[model samples]
Target chain A: MVAKELVLKAELRKKLGSKHSAKVRQSGKIPAVVYGHGQEPEMLSLDEHDFVEGLHHGHRLFDVQFEGKTEKLLVKDIQYDHLGKKIIHTDLIRVDLTERVEVEAPLIFKGTPAGSHEGGLLEEHLDHLEIECTVTEIPEAIDVSVKHLGIGDSIHARDIKLPDGIKLITDPDALLISCRLPAVTAAAPAEEAAEEGEEPTSPEVITERKPKEGEEESEK
Target chain B: MALMPKRVKYRKSQRGKMRGNATRTNYVAFGEFGLQSLETKWVTGRQIEAGRVAASHFLERVGRVYIRIFPHKSITKKPLETRMGKGKAEVEQWVACVRPGTVMFEIGGVAENVAKRALARVAHKMPVKCRFVSRRHTIG
Candidate 1:
């Protein structure tokens, strides 16, 4: 569940497309679309700073105020710029507080694994977990303990312990994290030695090679 | 040794134009943090090796460094003081054509600050401007 209800005021957007979106962004607002519940999609423009700040604060459900009415909306998707740094557009879906929704929650791996002391490296394979639960019961982040991990030990999605009322939606066999020793690169020298023993051959030329001066008479 | 393809169908390749932002392999897929390029250029294998060594040395082998780019395009060069009437020069080196928005290197199994510093050291070895990025820390 969210700590508090974050309310945002939005203005209805009439114009659309890349040009207008760029203009809206230049004016410090983000263009967003709201649709769900078999209703007509409404184009809206939100305060860029408030929207981005809310996302950074991990706000999933938002109470958007538009046209003198308030609607509960869930962040469906966010389109980023080419650099994947700035948010270009946002998609929101209508939702109720009582219905269940599937969301990708961030996974926080806590505790240093005992394997690290034995010259083992801890690697994180997955950072987020897909989960389903009521909108009001959504968790901010899931914490996975790694204190028991030893060398050659790994934790998969099925091994995670979820909070009450939350159901895991990701595949059970997906690997999340693992601890292993560093790989030794001894084969590099051997590969190079083998390559040196092979005869150098010219690559295929699109145009046939011309005959050498001594081979011209023989070819004729 | 630098990252390169063991074998290739062709040795020398045409110098194609580098235009537009990278559409594939632009996001952080494997690791927690990544080094993103801001310009388009050829990243040589030697430079890639240098960056890998830099990051690995800085981390003291505690974490893993994943090189996302491989030098596949072979570059050819003529010998010094050679005549102009000869055929094409031999393959001199290999490079990876890097466009803007490409995640060149990624570091995993380390703290965020450590990853940022390691990527920063790697940025010094790259030919283009680079920035550190992480898994999109956003809720759905």
Candidate 2:
């Protein structure tokens, strides 16, 4: 489904720097920067509540209104607090609706892999794939069915069947997901030993010792 | 009784920062569920063992648990009543330097709820705050 264009009222930010940004945040607004299409970057601020609500609407493209002009923009990046509990900053890029843009579309696995039921682990190697498509053609996410995946089976980027007009930009041979046995007991020892750069000798080997003959004889 | 190096290249070493991404081993990359730290702190080997025991006991050994960080850095301390100026102290314990957003542990081959509950128990044993993160929630 095509995401509906969200319209947000923003104000041009005059002051800059971490202190000013902190003040903006304290006032319940988020500091943001908008740039793209060969235009100079614009410092802006938006209502924190509205921006977050817009994100929940699943719309990446927005029509930001400020200074008597409406600019079509895409939500390029969002920086969150270390705890990922709050948004700290945002980056928006202007884009033409008709022009193709490169973005990372999240991959959604649709079903449980057959290997998982048989004690094999299903691992998603890549969570998103880089794709090029027009703003209107951008998919909220790409679904990958894993019901048929068995142990040792893998799905590569090239193997995915994309929607019409969506072109994959990631390496065709890049692994997306795979079904395999858990590496718990099998690979951990070697990997750990290699990382430590030596065999992790047992502590008992260093601490334990046989009593000397003199002590043993005296005890007897 | 606990995990530790049988021998160390040095008795004590400097406590370093836990900077950058977890790129050393596949430990952080492959787990289906994880406990991501929200604060930076030194995690002692005993604390890690307690976490491991909590998680494994809670899961009943139905799945695998991966410890992403190891207490490789040895901290030193002086004995009680010891005077200063005797050079550095003896090795006290080993600790792993953890940073905010570091994946402390991961679990695989278990149901989402089971992993969450198990990790919650593990979190109780840790010195820092943590949250449960799953592969699905992390991919995008």
Candidate 3:
């Protein structure tokens, strides 16, 4: 589903350079661009603080307080200072609430693991997932319970709960949680280990070779 | 007829100086930290981990925020010269670019601590090596 879009207000496109972009930054306006829906990529600017605030609260959507009434939008593309760095330029897609939109909702785990008390190690796998639904249907987050889930327990993508009219857009069998076996140390005596193993193995020896008629007495 | 001010008008304060470069010392002053809400939906064919799901929930429930990760060298033992990775650029303008290799970011508005935790998770889970830099921090 598509996310609800926000209307944007920006002035001027900035070129990538120190002197030019610096002049833009100096005015408390950060360099940005707004382009979508057959519109030519327009150069624009936003308040550095407001843009950063939007990135925090409304990562995908935010109300742009432009003109008079605030407009809503989805975060389309963001270029950071570098890889995994601060945001530089952000792309936004305008949305209409009446329309169905596609967006990614993050996955959330609910409750403490019952297996934690039992010393079973639990692992979380996927975090964010994508979906297509009405903007109004957009869920803040999805909650999956981990109560009483023990060792070897598993949950796949299909198991995550979805609100009515909302649908799953990820693979169903993708591994979500898994219980891992603890590692064993080699400091224990080999003899004690072999002694414990010998008893369980004794029955197997008797089953494998029924005594030959002549050797039966000797075997006995 | 002349265009009517083009709607939006922005002006800078009058006490501005020249455009010449100065002999600089490295420093940056970051703004208040903030958090944002992040979320995801379950798809049919995907694998969803409980911890990640939980982390996402925690983020959405708590919201995302910004915590400045500057003065990147202060916390670590390595010097900036010894550790600069790849092609990093410094802006000739803007006060934020005081440090040559320092990187800044607005953590997607989750709790500052929570955002750090989530990114830490990603770093460990990633197939390749990744590191994040932070110097000063305080929540308001």
Candidate 4:
């Protein structure tokens, strides 16, 4: 459980101006959108470093404190930049603590399986499953033990253990994890055969080039 | 897209007999109960009265609740109430009253997903669409 803290922000709502947001971004603060639950989405800016830290510790649930008030927000979506270095945008859902909320939780594999040691490939049919659960009781990750999984065994969504307040929103029979024989390719051996057929009788020629002096590019 | 194509059928015959076994409510407490009102809109008591009446009917069958409604904002050129005037189907906005605990949201003769339908039905006869919540989507 995480406690809510107020984020004192000076950037109040103002009329649109010429690339004012771009100018604000230059100041190192990132803008974010928060909405859902019958509320008008609002634009809120946060300190870049602080915002990243809050998201990094996203376990069950956290609050987004803006202005002088704090609201319980479930991290609905997070966007990333091209280089995947910066968090571009974040979507927050106002959650009712007791009311059941639908969330897609990650599936985590635990305990090495007998199939894994035998070189069987592990494949996951789904990355996440939607579950209807109380916000407070949301699991960090649903775990499935692969210790006894055979080469052809699979784990389904419904098989995952859920908390009392949680309901599996995914199809009951949908596959969650699968153990399978490793994929074998014929291309490598065929390439070796082709190389034997087309043997290079003579030594191959090689070439190297060196730039002349005074060809270096200048940097500003 | 995450939704599977397979139908999650809730057969009526099974539910009928199953209801007897579910005589005892199996719902756990939903934390310390509380309510937070987002907004409210005033409507003419004439046609919109049925929505409240129907909602209250289900509420009595269930328990205490909270309700909220706001004007539906539009960003499109074509408006919905062009053929008929605003009085026909006001469709002001979506309204909801969450019980928080075990909300068995059911509607119509059949127990189809009545959450969205229940809201739409409110404005059909009246100018209101009310949501009825119990414990779960499908009751025993």
Candidate 5:
């Protein structure tokens, strides 16, 4: 389902560059740039607390109001600080509601694969898929049920059932998830040794040996 | 200074391509954020030690820091003015080959601001450029 739209009040930023951005961040605001669909880029500042709260709610698309004008935008990218903790900058792209746009939608697995209980590990290879859909029909995430999956079973992008009007942009053959046996452990060799009633041998160590004087003389 | 192997079976190894996750430990399964490398380089033991020290010092022992890379490959250096025909020089130092997208460090058990600040110090000690990645962010 499409997430609820969040409306945020922002102010047009007159200053540009890193120095100004640093100053803006110091004043409890975040610096952002918005552009797309042939429109000129606009510099803006948002309340730090409000933007962070919206992020906590997984709100990617926003209605940004600045100078009595509001524009619908999708967050294209966000730059975080060196610790991946605080948001340092943001890139917002203007999105038309009626037009279909390609974006990555996260995949949400609904159920545990049946093989998981029998020592089979469920591995999810693709966490998101590129899809095309109208802005109004954009889904927050794509849910895939793995409850029926058994050992050696796999799910590909083509196997997904998209909602009406939504098209998959990623390769249909791309593997999304799979169930496989667990990796072999180091104890396998010891088990084999025990079955034969012999002591387990240590692994061979490869190394270079010093040339003996007699061998050197023989070569000469 | 850092820990060094007392002895190694081989002084040098053949140039091997890091093809398809050769290392068994590939992912940062623990920690909230990871320091992922953007380029391939030889990260020496001293560099890793320095980074660990810097991070631990900054965090003041409140947060846990995980060093994901280990300098296992022995690097040898010849003595000055030595003849070219001599055998391989003794192992001088150890290094860890960091490929693109390798998580070299992981930080957790602390507030976001504290972890970021502590990791920033660690980044300054690294050879290659790195970015902070959250555990929630899926790597492509």
Candidate 6:
């Protein structure tokens, strides 16, 4: 189900650039831009606390109250700091309540796979999948149950049961998760060396050893 | 043994600079929790191995630990008593040049608290500062 609609108060930003953005963040607001429908992108600032709270609560659609008008906006992208800790910037796009759009939906694998209990390693190859759905039908996340998976069993994108009105856009053959036996540990290195037809020795040593005189005489 | 390229085009490489944040493979992709680098540095092969051991030991073989970075760049060193070398030093070790925002290690098939503690043990073995990151939440 789509998240609850959140209304955030915003103001038009006049000063632009890294300097201004730093100041905006210092003032407890996130620098953002809104653009869509071939309209000029407008710079704006949003309350950081409110924006972060909305995100934590899984709210993607927001009604931005700006200059005596409200605009329906969808979060298109968010740029985090170098440490991936703080939000540095955000991109919002205009959208209607009924408009259909494509967006990435995070896939949550629920329940431990039965294969795992059988000594199989559970690996998730994809964390999210591309999906197309109406603005109001966007879900917080797609839940996939792995409880029934057994050894050598896997789930592909096509196997997922998406929510009503939601269509999967990712490659149908893409592997999302799998349960497999753990790799053999012992003798793996030796087997690899035998495959390569090389003596078991460190590859870092580049110097060649000279043959001993006794060995040369014996060969002769 | 720690991960190293079976063969490299060059035996030794210069200490290149790490600039800006990682542009690719920066998010938690393959696992539920990840250890993200907060600074740029050359993570040595030994360090990678140590971190892996640390995390795996902490998890007690209950989960899988994935090493995202490989030590492909070979670093060289000169003898301690040697004066100015006539040529570059010999190959000593290998390292992976990690930039900020890079997810160097990931832990999966574990509980949130377990994953956090496991990755914390890994961070203790890493040279760069690290933080725990989860899969980013998004909606269509």
The candidate scoring highest on TM-score is 1
Give lDDT tens digits, candidate 3, residues B28-125.
22311211111111111001122233344444433322222211111112345665664333211111112222222223322346666765553343
TM-score of every model versus the real structure: 0.87, 0.81, 0.47, 0.49, 0.61, 0.84
Candidate number with greatest lDDT: 1
lDDT of 2 by residue, A81-170 (tens): 654557889999999989898888888778888987887777667888999999888777888998999999999999999988999999
Please give the ranking of all candidate structures by lDDT, highest first, separated by commas. 1, 6, 2, 5, 4, 3
The pairs that clash in candidate 5 are none
* A9-59 per-residue lDDT for model 3 (tens digits): 566554766677768877877776555566566556777776776545534
Instruction: Report the C-alpha lDDT of model 5 over A1-220, residue by residue, as the tens digit.
Output: 6474799999999989999999999999999999998989999998889988886776777899998999998877787663445688888889988878787888877786798777676666677889888877767778899998898999999999999999999999999888776555333464455568883232223575778999999999
Backbone clashes in model 1, listed as residue pairs: none
Location of the lowest summed lDDT over 10 successive residues in candidate 4 chain A: A199-208
List model 6 lDDT by residue over B35-133, tens digit each: 999888999988997898788778776768878899878888998999995999987788999998999998887789999999999999999999999
- Candidate 5 residues lying further than 4 Å off, grouped into runs, are A185-220, B1-89, B97-134, B137-140
Q: Every model's DockQ, to 2 decimals?
A: 0.41, 0.23, 0.02, 0.01, 0.08, 0.35
TM-score of 3: 0.47
Q: What is each predicted model's overall lDDT from 0 to 1?
A: 0.86, 0.80, 0.46, 0.47, 0.76, 0.86
Clashes of each: 0, 0, 58, 10, 0, 0
- TM-score for candidate 2: 0.81
Candidate 3: docking tier: incorrect
Give fnat for candidates 1, 2 and onward, in order: 0.35, 0.19, 0.00, 0.00, 0.08, 0.31
> Which of candidates 2 and 5 is the stronger one according to lDDT?
2
Q: Is candidate 2 or candidate 4 better by DockQ?
A: 2
lDDT digits (tens) for residues A1-220 of candidate 1? 4563589999998888889978989999999999999999999999999988887787888899999999999998998876898888999999999989999988889999999889888988888999999888878888899999999999999999888899999999999999999886443464475568853344455455667988988878
Candidate 2 pairs with clashing backbones: none
Q: Write the per-residue lDDT of candidate 6 for residues A1-220, one digit (tens) a residue.
A: 6465899999999999999989999999999999998889999999999999998888889999998999999999998876667898999999998899899988888998899888888888888899899888878888999999999999999999987899989999999999988775443474466668874333543454669999999999
- Sorted by TM-score (best first), the order is 1, 6, 2, 5, 4, 3
Q: Candidate 5's residue-wise lDDT over B54-124, tens digit each?
A: 88778654546778888878777889998887777766777888876678988854556877788888889
